[model samples]
Target: MNPAGDPFLEACSKTFEDQFSPLEVAGIGSFGIVFSATTKSKSHIDKLGTPQHRDASEGSGTQALQAVKLCLPGCPSGIKGSTSRLQAEIEAMRRVSKNTTPSVRHLFAELYAFNTSNEPWYSMEFILPGVTLQQVFDVASAASYPFPEEIVFHVADQAARAFQYLHDQCRFVCTDISQSNMMLRYPGKEVSVMPDLVLIDWSFWAEASDQTTTCAVRNLYNCLAPVFFDAGWRCSRRHDRDSCAASGVFHSC
Candidate 1:
C-alpha cells in the first residue's frame, strides 16, 4: 500500500440519498444479495444508466425504480477473489450496455457500480411491478393451472433476440440463462401481446475476445438451473451453435 494512499480510490465510493427508496429483497445467492428501490430524480441516474421507459405523454418527473446488489455482511474481509469478482461483473455490464440495440436495450438493466473499500455494491434499473418466470410458474401451479405455453414461447422468442444482440453485436455470451434470470413486467395488462422480458444476472457472462478459442470461451456454459429439453440444446452448446441459436430460450439454461 502507498503511504499517501490513492486519491482516485474515492471515485469508486458511492453514497445514496433519500432519493432512493429501498423496497424488498430482490434475491440472495452466492453472487450477492439484491435489493429493490426507486429513484426519485433523473439526476440520480448514472451517466450510462437506463432511464425508465416512460410514455412521452406522461412528460417529466418520471422516476425509475432500480435494484441493487451488495456483498453479504458476514463475508470474510480478506477472502480470496471477492473484490476481483465484483470488479469483473462491473466491467462485463459496462461493456454490454455500451453497444445496446433498439430492441434488446432493455434486456439488461444499466449498471451503477461502486466500491467503498470495505464493502461493494451496484445498482441497476429497478424493475418494478414485475415478476420472474419462476414466480409465474409457481402461481399457476398453486392455482392448479398450467403456465400458458404460448406466453412462454413468446417470452422465449424475445429473449432469443436479446441473446442475439448480446452475441452478435456485443461479442458477449450469456452463460447463465434460466427462468429465474428472466423477469416480466405485466399486470392489469393482457398477455395476448408479448410482455416485455428482461434478462438479469451477469455473474458468469463472458466477453469474447477476438482471439477466442473453443475451450476457453465458446464451450463454457452455466450449470446452474439446467432445464434442457429436446430442442437440440446440447448440440447448440457443443458446436458453439448457441452463439446464434435463438431457440435456446425455450430451455432457458
Candidate 2:
C-alpha cells in the first residue's frame, strides 16, 4: 500500500502533527510495517533528540531520516499481542540504551519515541548506507565469491559481544537472530577498517525471567536450536547463542 493512503501513516501524521513525512516502506511483516520517514520540521527533530552517530550532513539543515514501525492490529494471525509485543520491543531498546557501554550500545539502534495510544507506533534511528548481512551473502553467492575469513570473524565478534550484553547485563534474549537482523554500517569504508555491526529488529526479544514460550519460534526454524523443537522447552540465553551460531554458519555456507 502507498504510504500516503495507509491508515497507519495517516494516523501517525495526524497524531504527530505531520512532523514526519513518509518516504517509503522499509520493511513489512506480519506484526507491523516499518516506514522510512524524515522529520518535517526542526522542532520534531528536537523533540526526538539527536542520534549519536548522525552524520554531519544531517546537522547542516537537512531533514533527519528515521524508521517508524506501526503495529498491525490482530497480528500473528489469531494472536492479538501485536501492541504488547511492540511495547516490549521499545522497552528492550530503552533498557539497552540506558545500561550498556558506549561500544556495545552503538551496536543496537537507538529508540527515539514511541506511542501505544491508538495506532501503536515507534520511531528509531535509521542506518544509512548500510547493508544487511543477508544482502551481502546473496551478492557473494551470485558472484561465487566467499567473504574473507577476517571479515567473517569481525562480524561474528561484534555480534557475540552484543548478544553477551543482552544476555548477561540486560537479562534479555533476542529470540530472533538471522542474517537480515545484522547490518554492516558504512560498507563502503576501506577494507582495512572494520565496519560497525548494528543489530536490528527487537520484535522477538524476551526477558530471561520470562519462562513462557514465544511466538518467535514460529518463523525462526532455520536459526532456532534443536531444543526449541521440544514440546515445552522455554527460551533462554542459550537459544540466542545457538541461533547466532546457526545463522553464522547458514550465511557463510
Candidate 3:
C-alpha cells in the first residue's frame, strides 16, 4: 500500500497539522505507519514535559525531530484495541524509563507524547544517524567485509542488559527480538565505528509469567527458545534471552 496515499496518514496530517509538520513516512508495518516529523514549535513539546534522555535545552531554538507511529484506520485489531495497544506500548516504555539503569536507559527510546482520544498515535525520540542491525549486516555482506566480532559482542552485551532490566524490573518479555528491531545509533558529529545498540518495536512484548501464555508462535518460531516449541510452555525470561542469542548468531554469521 502507498503510505502517502493512506487515508490514516492524511487524517493524522490534518489532525496534528499545527503541532507537527513535514511528516515523512519512515517505515510501514502491519499495525501502523511510522512518520519521521519535526514539531513545529517547542511549546507543543514543552506541554508533554521534558524527555528522559534528551537535554531540556537542546531544542529550545529549533524544531525537534520525532518518530510518530500512527495506527492504521482499522489496525491488526479494531480502532479501540489498537489505541489501547499504543497506549500500552507507551506505558511500557515509561516503565523502562523510570526503572532502568542510567547506562542502559539510552537503549530504549523515550516517549514524548501520545493521543488515544482522536487519531490514535504516539511520538518518540527519533534515533538520528542510526541504522537497523539488519541494514548493518546487509552492508557488510555487500562489501564482502567480515562483520566485526567485537561489534557482535558489543550488541549482545548491551541487549542482554536491556533484557535483564525488562525481565527483572518490569516483569516483561520482549517476544520479538530480531536484527531488524535492533538499531545502532551513532551519537556524535562524526560516525563512530562502534555504535550504541537501541532496541525498538515493543508492539509484541508480553508480561513475563509462570503460567502458559499463548504467543504468536508462527511469528516467533525461528528465534524462539526451544521450550516454546512444546505444546504448553510457560513464558519466562529465557524466552527473550534465547531469542537474542539466536538473532545474534544468525545475523553475525
lDDT of 1 by residue, 1-253 (tens): 1212422122111234445555555555555556666665555554434334443113565555666665544334322344565666777777877888666766675565455366455445445457776676566545656444455455656655666677777787766656687778753123435567776777666765554423222232231112222211233345554464434543333
Q: Which portions of model 3 miss their true places by more than 4 Å?
A: 1-8, 43-63, 74-76, 118-123, 188-193, 210-253
- What is the Cα-based lDDT of residue 148 in candidate 1? 46
Judged by whole-model lDDT over C-alpha atoms, candidate 2 comes out at 0.61
Candidate 3, pairs of clashing residues: none
- Candidate 2, residues 1-253, lDDT tens digits: the string is 2457767566556555466777676777567667777777666555545453344226576666677777765345212566677777888888888788866766787686777765545545555557776777666656666455455556656766777688779877777777687778854223336777787888777766534123333323343222122222232455565455435533333
**Tens-digit per-residue lDDT, 153-238, candidate 3:** 56556666677678779887777767677778865212256767787777667887653122322333333222122223233455
Instruction: Give the worst 10-residue stretch by lDDT in candidate 3.
Output: 224-233
Q: What are the Cα lDDT values of the candidates?
A: 0.53, 0.61, 0.61
The better candidate by lDDT, 1 or 3, is 3
TM-score of 1: 0.63
TM-score per model over all chains: 0.63, 0.70, 0.70
Query: What TM-score should be assigned to candidate 3?
Result: 0.70
In model 1, the runs with Cα more than 4 Å from the true position are 1-15, 45-63, 72-80, 112-121, 187-192, 207-253
lDDT of 3 at 246: 41
Runs in model 2 deviating more than 4 A are 1-17, 43-52, 56-62, 74-80, 117-123, 187-192, 209-253
